[model samples]
Target: MELHIVIEGKKDLGGQLYRQLSDSIRSGRLADGQQLPPSRLLAEQLGLSRKTVSNVYTRLTQERLVLGQVGKGSFVSAPAEAKPRRQLAINLASAAIVAKWDSMHTPLRAPFPEERSRYEFVGGCVTPALFPIDEWRRCMLHGLRQDVKGSGMYRQAEGIAELRAAIAHHAAFARGVVCTANNVVVTNGAQQALDLLGRVLLEPGCVVAVEEPGYPAARMLFASQGARVVGIGIDQEGMLVEQIPQGTRLIYTTPAHQFPLGMQMSVARREALLARALAIGAIIIEDDYDSEFRYDGRPTDSLQSMDRHGVVAFVGSFSKVMLPELRLGYAVLPEAILNAALTVKHLNDWHTATASQHALAKFIADGYLSRHIRRCGATYATRRERLQTLFADVLSPWFELVPASAGFHLAALCKKPLDLDLLLRLARRADVGLHPLSNFYASTPPRAGLFLGYGGIETLDIEIALLRVRDILLQME
Candidate 1:
């Protein structure tokens, strides 16, 4: 292959080539045993004399960056250790930042397996083909026109007024959340809403209760703020409210659909959860993430709707319903928490992008958002049914399907314990993606199961992916 090296305006052509080639080898851009271009060919390409190129090759050979054979051309040698650019005044080994960070350790988590896997069952992702590209483009153009004509002023830190009004309207009609535009605070995503809550509500050593086998991102967000996050176990009804410890400062729950394990929080349990938060004076964060798409049963009201006292802050996202890249979600706060959360949000990022906010506002007002959800929901329902049927028919011997009525994924509890390590290895061999249910737990022991997400996976490809999964299961047994 021809190496692209420039020898421009340099008096010492041989020295320049030698330095560049040496840097390439030391950086491992040129792998060991990889053949280099012939000296004459490289000389012509770089507009340098052949003799100059030969001298550079000789210099590289002396530095052990390349090997020369009599008949064969030069080849790259093992990478040499790079020299330090400058002398260090302070050693990292003795720095205070290093010692402080050494005491703090964060768990390593993988990105969505779908990024690399062909037949991905990864959760929390939407199919790009389903996005309303043309409509969104028009809305974006409208936003650009508005920006051009409007006065150049810093917009509201809470959010642009139009987008907040649209979100408030959507929440009131769609999810049974009782709120007005004044009560909403726009955030980058639901994750940022959690961070804002943690900032305003949680102090060091504060106790935070969350559903066990819950959204790991929320748990980590709270933990990063130095709050002691205690995991509360859940039954079919939802989080065991009676078991919640007293003196808790904040509580986080996915009431609409308990994440990973999909089940709605029963009405009685919802009332009990509200009562518990009221009694302890703890703030509640209701993540109504995927509540927009329900397939079965009558819809349940949000915990925020039942609060007579200002105890619940409702957070919703367009990541699951619309597109993850939108980076838009809003929190409907009780009168008491709204101002504090807004301040923290301003401190966080000085509000989310205004242009997307304008675009989304138009999308919602023109009813495009509603239409998109309806279209995507119908497609997702069929995929969900196909997966459930596959689990019931072929995989029933080793798995028990969890009752999931909404959202893009399902969980299957193991019938009998199987070596998860061996099963994962077999799955890798079969080229199927699988995530264990155990990874979601923070305190309680994890149950053996799999979380199969269909958002990114195609409807036609579902059967074929499961067939491979079934084969792997049988081979593991």
Candidate 2:
């Protein structure tokens, strides 16, 4: 690499070279073991004598900042203890808005490297063993070919035409969502869809209602946008529509299957939520995440399907069914919010990745998505059954399983008060990962319960993991 050195009126050329080289070395700009430009070449570039450059190298060598080799050029020496680079001092006055962001909590996060257990019952995670790798690889190849022949311009913010159409058709067929390509907006993930909707619909201090003991990420997201987020308590039906504040501009619900506590919202409550939204002129953001893996009962209509007055913005994600790393999801927006949402999406990230969109479009178009879902569903169903049996037979004394028709996870409310923290610790010690229901609640006092997700853990491993949990509870008793 060419070295940069300045000479002022040809005065103290060696000293100038030494200072700059020393600073670069000390600051880690010239990384350890990196070869410096030869003295002759550097002297020619800087319009200085080779003797001056060599003297500077010699000085650096004496300081132990440079290593001289017999045949090769000088290189930076590795220090025994690498010095940390100096950081700029923060001197500006703190902003109130930034302080608010700092105070916000992130409830849903991946465990650290050390925190990972052998049998993880973590929610929102999928089994890697069940993914259709061969089928997906073929689809990805098709996406690559399409990308190669593309216009090389930024695609539409609403999404590639094929994906939007595919999503519309899939949503209609599977979840009973009524929409066309024009209504769909493909996003990075369901999270981005929520963010775009929040940007379009929510103003600072606007009232937004989410379910108590609900998806914490959604609650924190709306709060980050300066919206006044309120937690409406949930029962067997879902979010209590009667308790929704009068001034609420937005109401977010996972009606297909409630988050953390898995329960499909009843038809009566769905109609009531729609009526409430219509009466208050509030928009409902129905997050239909992980609804494709329903194991029992007849399929129910989504909130978008039940919507009459264009009040629901139906959001869905492929993360639960497919790989979460895909970061692919879509929102079927009502006509009122569609254009504004598209515009916001354009401003957000230009658009979701085109290659993945093309791959998913092909995945759905060729029926691979449906086939994959069926295959994974069977595995998840078996796991869920194992968990149900364990809870019913071995662990019945400590917990009562919440009846849920869909989704990969189950919620078990405690029979009586117990040390949840201690149970989690003991489970971790036994190489089992356990999650509590307390993390989901916002305003209400959290009930003592556990969320046992069957998606990540193996079918056989679920029994062993729960058995260990039961043993821990026995010890506590």
Report the number of the highest-TM-score candidate.
2
C-alpha lDDT of candidate 2 relative to the true structure: 0.90
State model 1's lDDT.
Answer: 0.86
Instruction: Give the per-residue lDDT digits (tens) of candidate 2, residues 111-146.
Output: 797988999988989988889889899999999899
Q: After superposing candidate 1 on the true structure, give the runs of residues whose Cα lies further than 4 Å from its correct spot.
A: 1-115
Collision pairs in model 2:
none
Worst 10 residues of 2 by lDDT: 78-87
TM-score to true structure, per model: 0.81, 0.90
With candidate 1 superimposed using the best TM-score fit, by how many Å does residue 68's alpha carbon deviate from the native?
29
Candidate 1, which ten residues in sequence have the lowest lDDT sum?
Answer: 104-113
Report the lDDT tens digits of candidate 1 across residue range 54-135.
9988988897888999899899996656443455676666587556556653322446545456777778889988989999
